[model samples]
Target: MKKKYLIIGAGPTGLGAAHRLRELGADDLLVLERHGHAGGLSASFKDDKGFTWDIGGHVVFSHYEYFDALLDSLLGDERLEHQRESWVRSCSTWLPYPFQNNIRHLPPQARWECVEGLLPGNRPEAAPADFGQWIEGVFGTGIAKYFMNPYNFKVWATPLELMQFGWIGERVSVVDLRRVLRNIILERDDVSWGPNNTFKFPLHGGTGEIFRRLAARLDGFIEYGQEVAAIDASARTVTTKAGLTVEYETLLNTAPLDILASRWLADRDQTMVEAADRLTHNSVYVAGVGLDIQREAERNPRCWMYFPEQDSPFYRVTNFHNYSPNNVARPGRQLAFMCETSYSAHKPEKLDELMDQTIAGLVNTSLLDAARAADVLTRWETAVDYGYPVPCLERDGALKAIQPRLEALGIFSRGRFGGWKYEVGNMDHSVMQGVEWADRMISGTPETTYRWE
Candidate 1:
């Protein structure tokens, strides 16, 4: 088979590209998806018990107008808007999200420690070199010790020193001594600091509904269950594991860049393999625990909570039922908890025992009652091999070496893992990367979201 454009992995990026290509009057494009379904990491599932759950904690918030417009067009009135009520669990108490800003909620001793560390010259004077140092320099020893250090390690599953600080743009809420003190003195709840303060959710299905509706617009263009096996870049051809080969004038890869470079490419060299080796990522295990709401105290207004302490194996847990009433079988009468635990070589976890560990964690963190363990209606879980694309010290340098070389061969890699950029790997950014790539391909418009430099 031959096509003008070929895209691998029909996730947000591939679907977005196909949608835009068609909109721009280009029909000679095809998207290859390994799974029989679409949505990639954003996909949702319904257990036999009728509870819907996403892969992890995914909230629909955008940094792009085009992405917002696309979502508006796709879901229309089928979506629900939500005010983010996020919190942090530390010192066996719940504090507002961005723990540093709400140190007042902590016990007097812990709160004073946070403030004392932020005083005049307690923090490091020199410019920080890594994420670990940056956390200390910016948040001070107290905040880092209480929240940032442990929470980040649990989420990233990587040593903070090995990771770089460039990726912490809007993702982290950076606070200073004055801001910290003022919030405490003024007794203010500084919860509305981030871009996802107000977000949207699908009223019926989980977060995947947005992508599912988008994929439907480009029906015949996407070929499901066709995982790419090898790509001869020089020949501009791709071979799938199902023994089908397709030649293309141009290719867009929405899969992991490391795998594309090290495992897929037929003519890859030493530099490409070495560059690929430097691109590190952490795997995630998402456990969805659901049960009937037995008591009034079982419901909470908070959307999600972070676990910085070792009491919970999971770093984050989303009150999935709060996002949409339709998430559970009985709506307001049921509860759905989606917990995420990340693991990597730096922080190994017993995947086999994580579900049980997660349940125990929920109880330990006070989300679940110890006696209600037997009442769980469903325990749905999935382990994703490529969860977060780690912003390692060598990531930028590796991308600089690999991306340009691939682009020279009429191949473009974009999206979350494809671009290997955690900073712009959100759903909106991933889709726009593909849309921009399509624009660049068809009309010579420059791509902006995932710049290797």
Candidate 2:
């Protein structure tokens, strides 16, 4: 082997970098994956019935043309595109997705109150410093209290007030008061406003399969099940969990930077380990339910919905079977996918109790019916300890405090957790990070998405 570029964690990021290197006719690339597969937490599995589901919901919505082109080249025509009809289920009603901005669905009393808060005459003459303040700036206090604030705390596992509003980009909705009021008076849903209105999903395998296929294509370059245990920056060498060492000119790590930092610290002493402890990530428990519903995937083409009310342990539910017919067993087949949830530490719910409660909540919410149901087929979990990178008030301070010093030591950390910018850290962003890293390393191209883009 040519002792080439060492790519850690064969997730989307690593695989993307390797594939890009090969596509560019570059050589001496080695990808080390911790798990036995290409996809990390974004991996997928099949039930005995051959139904495919991602570790969690991994929808494909990219900002880069390269990402879309890469995916199309992989899956080709066997892809499914869906228009998301998402809404917030609260106050015993289904408010449209831009819930705060679309308060026309709310009852008369609530609507008038929201209007007074947001209506042009009473606009606040200030800028928002926190997520809560941003909500008030965008939707006003009345609407913020009703959905934006609590729903955010439930989803992000951090209080809105504790988070800086800088990360909020196209991820949120800022309503035009006049347009909102006009649409509301006309009894319009206006749900088709966001960037995810039309999104693409894999037709056969789960979202993870895209990376799996990418790995298979780059067979000679990637080594699965090879976990990176340590990195010696002085000599530019990487040691695997299994004691195998490889020397590289430059390394791109897709593993959590904190984890990689810990391993690098372990190669030294306790002082570095103490500093590494400041990095925080939320653990997520995803419960995948396989149910026996009568409706075919076509009838319920609706992808997923959010339930922020007190009745459900799951903050969000993906109609997995509906997302892709291949996600569940066919009509005569045995296993049919039901729902999937992302449970974080903020609203920690017991797995057993929460699952049962979730099923009951499904019945109550007219999702899973009591009368027509098959025995609960499968209930397995995919727990990710480093799911969400908490955007705490101190996150920027902590990163600036630690990351630059690490970077100074010849460590180029970049990935979902590596860069710690959730706004762009989806599969696409992760891949782009790797691409940019490799490009910068090889050709000295501008790596915009690494820190800023």
Candidate 3:
């Protein structure tokens, strides 16, 4: 097969590129998806029991007008808007989402410790070199000890010192001594600190519905169940595991850049291979626990909660039923908890033991009662090999070395794992990366969302 453009992995990035390419009057493009279905990490599943769950905690919020317009065009009235009600589980109590800003909710002793650590002379004077030091320098010892350290470790499954602080842009709510004290004194919750304060959800399916509808419009442009096994960059050709080979003038790779460089690329050299080795990522296990809503207490308004302590094996759990009533078997009559636990070489977890551990964790963290364990209607779990693209100390350097070399061969890698940038790796950013890549390819528009430099 021959084509003008060939895209690997029909997730948001690939689909976005294909959709935009068609919109721009380019029809000679094809998207290859390994899975029979689309949506990639944003995908959702409906269990046999009729409960719907996303791969993890995914909320539809965007920073791009194009993404908003795309979502509006795709979902229309089939989506639900939601006010974010996020919280933190710490000190045997629930505090508002930004734990530092709501230190007043903590017991007096813990609250005092947090405030005391933020005092004028307590924090370090020098600029921090790594995420671990940055957490301490910015949040102080108390806040880091109580929330930032443990919660980040649980989420990233990487040693904080090995990671860089550059990715914390809007993802983390950075607070200072005055802001922390004022919020406590003013009795403010300070819940609205990030971009996802107000978000949208699909009314029927899970988060995947947005991508599903978008993919539907592309139709024949996408070929499912085709996993690219090898790529001859010099010849601009791709070979899939199913024994099909396609030659293209240009290629867009939405697969992991490390794999594309180390395992797939036929003419990769020592520099590309070494750079790929420096790129690291953690795996994630998502457990969807569902049950009949037996009591009024199960109908909480909070959307999700973070677990920073050892009581919960999961770092985060989303009240899936709250996102949309249709998520459960019975609308507004059942509960679905989508829990996420990340694991990596730095923080190894027994994948086999995680479900039981998660259930026990839910009970320990008070989301589930000990007696209701037997009443669980569904305990569905799925594990993804590439979860979060870690912003390691060597990440930027690795990308600088690898991306330019790939682009020189008429191959462009963009998306979450493809770009290997967690800072701009949200659904909106991922899609825009593809859209921008398409624009750059067809009209010579420069790419902005992702730049290796």
Which residue pairs collide in model 3, if any? none
Global local distance difference test of model 1:
0.93
Predict model 2's lDDT versus the native.
Answer: 0.72
Off by over 4 Å in 2: 120-124, 266-276, 295-299, 331-346, 372-374
Against the correct fold, how does model 2 do in TM-score?
Answer: 0.91
**C-alpha displacement of 170 in model 2, angstroms?**
0.7
TM of each candidate vs. truth:
0.99, 0.91, 0.99
lDDT of 2 by residue, 1-453 (tens): 336687887888888888888777777879888778888877888766456667766788888999999999999998888888676777767776878657788878778777888866565658877878778877877777677776776677666787888877887877787887887888877787777788888887788878888889888777767777677877778888777888887677778867776765435444445545666666666767675555553244456766766666556777777667778766344334344444554556565575677677776666666764447777655667777776666666666655666666666777888777677677888899888877877788988776732
After superposing candidate 3 on the true structure, give the runs of residues whose Cα lies further than 4 Å from its correct spot. Answer: none
Query: Distance (Å) between predicted and true CA of 406, model 3?
Result: 0.4
lDDT for 406 (candidate 1)? 94
Query: Which tens-of-lDDT digit does each residue in 130-240 have in candidate 3?
Result: 999999999889899899999999999999999999888888888867888788889987887889999999998898898899899999988889999999988889999
- By TM-score, the better pick of 2 and 3 is 3
True-structure lDDT of candidate 3? 0.93
Q: Give the per-residue lDDT of model 1 (tens digit) for 1-453.
A: 999999998889888999999999999988999999999998999999999999999998998899989998998899999999999999999999989899999999899888888888899989899999999999888899899999999999999999999899999988867888788889998898899999999999898898889889989988999999999988999999988899999999999999999999998888999999999999999999999998999999999999999998999999999999999999899999999999999989999999999999999999999999989989999999999999999999999999999988889999999999999988899999999999999999988887997
